[model samples]
Target: MTTETRPPAAPPRVDTSRRTRAPLHLGWWLAAAVIGLTLLNIGSVVVRSPNLDWSVVWEYFLSTDVLAGLARTVELTAIAMACGIVGGVILAVMRLSPVPVVSWAAKSYVWFFRGTPLLVHILFWYNLAALVPAIAVEIPFGPTLFEVDTNDLITPLLAAVIALGLNEAAYMAEVVRGGLLSVDPGQTEAAKALGMTHRQTLRRVVVPQALRVVIPPTGNQVISMLKASALVSVTSTPELLYSVQVIYNNNFKTIPLLVVASAWYLIVTSVLYVVQHHLERRFSRGTGRG
Candidate 1:
């Protein structure tokens, strides 16, 4: 039809000024509320319990014996880690050697140490006198050069150190090997292209870079070693847990003494965490994670 047609009137506009709201996340809120209440209840109970004896905890928290034990624990951690680092480096290099016998020897060492229980290792070292009776330095086909009774040579403290250190070495060898492996092959080739020898490339290029990957785990190992020092108490080497045990045995205030030990552990571990954080940050520089 020729009749003028006006566009159909626009449909009546719907009001969208009031948009639908999102759900309130009631389930998550409820769960958080329940968790908060549970934690609060537990805290209240722990704080108010008559059996806890907070005063006794404070009494022995920094006693001389406990302090000495803490020092021994730190000493063990330091010595064991030093031994582990040196031994681990040697084993890692041997494991990566071109000679099959060398590699196999390293592998065997790691396998034997890692597979056995550390407790047994500690006990074995402590009782080494029973097995070998004596330690001697001798010429294979000639006269003995030196001899010392095993018991005399391996005192309880020495036994603990040797056991902990050797055990730690097996684990550290794997750690060091993994770190070395993390370095790019291209970097080694580049170092060789610049006329670097194998040792030179490792010492100058590979190790420095590998430290970035190696340090964090090494720090963790130190913390673990600190805690593990407690096991040395079996050898009657006084460390943190053992010191606490001696006190509780005499006074029979077991829980409070245990609390003291636990408190010290928490404090020390917290300090280690801080140190580890700083070390990680120092090494992680230039990497975005830093």
Candidate 2:
């Protein structure tokens, strides 16, 4: 009876008169700032156009040769990325192997390839036919079984693919390794307790989870590969930059031809960015709710 007479708990101390400021719309301010910056940039470009002809730029981009070059650039990127993914998985496994020799070999490969500039690697591979006169097949520390002329075996296109794929693999191995490392050790333990072998656990439990980590960086790498395909021009593979160069060399409209190449690169990069965004969202779905 005494506890019931406690003055109704002071009306629960409700602060009804307190004023709350409305939440600021920072997004609107950010949009305005972006618009201002874009206008400034456009003004600067217009001001800097000494003897610029917009028509020539448009014409160059619309040309059949430029379209052909774009197609070839797409082809090179597809081939290189496919080869890179396969090689990267192999190298990543090698790097993670319990055997010291396999790990050492993988480490050495990454070291040498990553230490050198990719452009240099491309050039070296292009000239590898001269450096190594024959492509010989033999058992380790045994007599040669067969030989093919290096120049015949390695075409410039093939050389470009090999160089791009091998170089990308060095970088991609690290990406994959990082993804694999991110998976919880407990998951592997549980998989083993459930009678899964190491390889089976890795393939089933580890890689699926690792893919969530691996895919974003791999998308970025694909975008980078798209740009790096230009380097194939050095080997006369007639990719986008090479085709543009050929056009400019003939017509001497260097700026316009470059603009064409830049436009295509921009378009491709934009598409890749869109793909990356969706992929990141897909992977992030379950992560945010908890």
Candidate 3:
């Protein structure tokens, strides 16, 4: 009663005039430094008078073979990503399985694939025909089925796709598992209470919710896979980089050819970034304080 009588406690001393500011203003300082360094670098390049031939860049872009190579690159990315997503979902489920054996197997698969460098995986797949001369099929604890020649069955393209997809699946499995784990247990419980089976709960409740958490990283993975498609050139898959190498090797226009490939990569990645922004917004809507 005495405190309440003390002029309403000075209105609790709200510091309404306290102007909050960032302690360091580091962002503005960093931006200015970056601009200064970039200008300096550009000035140095200009002073060096390095040949900046726009005509060669244009010619490389307009070339039919380069266009074909670009198409093949896109095709490879799509196929590999499709395979990776499917394989990853299966692996994620396996890893989360109640059975110890299934979970262990999934963990081992992910460990082996992820521990190994992707380039090595690609090389191994390319040489898989040499390692295992014949491919055999047999049911578990059953007689062997008809066998096929491994070398004959696996083309370089197929090997590249398998290698990239399987390797990517390992990483994507972790991403998916993380997303699934991020979802509340109550969601699954609620779905089960509503008479949904485990599979139905996962499909209708879990995956849809997890996808919001998954899409950003998955989109980044897709972009990376597009770039990684260039690695197939080591196996002579005639993808974007391989085609550019062929052109330059013929005409010795190495710089121009590289620039062409770079331009296409930049353009594609920029478009992908825009798509990713829209996808993130679409998925994030209604899931939060938005």
Q: Report the number of the highest-TM-score candidate.
A: 1
Candidate lDDT scores, in order, read 0.92, 0.89, 0.89
lDDT of 1: 0.92
> What tens-digit string does per-residue lDDT give for candidate 1 at 3-92?
998999999999899899887798989999999999999999879988889999889998999999999988998999999999998999
lDDT of 3 at 156: 86
**CA displacement after TM-score superposition, residue 188 of candidate 3 (Å):** 1.7
Model 2 poorest 10 in a row by lDDT: 1-10
Query: Candidate 3 on 38-109: residue-level lDDT in tens?
Result: 999998774554565667789889689898999999999999999999999999999999999999999999
Report the Cα lDDT for residue 226, model 1: 85
Q: Kindly provide the TM-score of model 1 when superposed on the true structure, using C-alpha atoms.
A: 0.87
State candidate 3's TM-score.
0.84
Using all chains and alpha carbons, the TM-scores for the candidates as numbered come to 0.87, 0.82, 0.84
lDDT of 2 at 213: 91
Q: In order, what is each prediction's RMSD in angstroms?
A: 8.1, 4.9, 4.1
**Which residue ranges in model 3 land beyond 4 Å of their true spot?**
1-34, 43-48, 136-148
RMSD of 2: 4.9
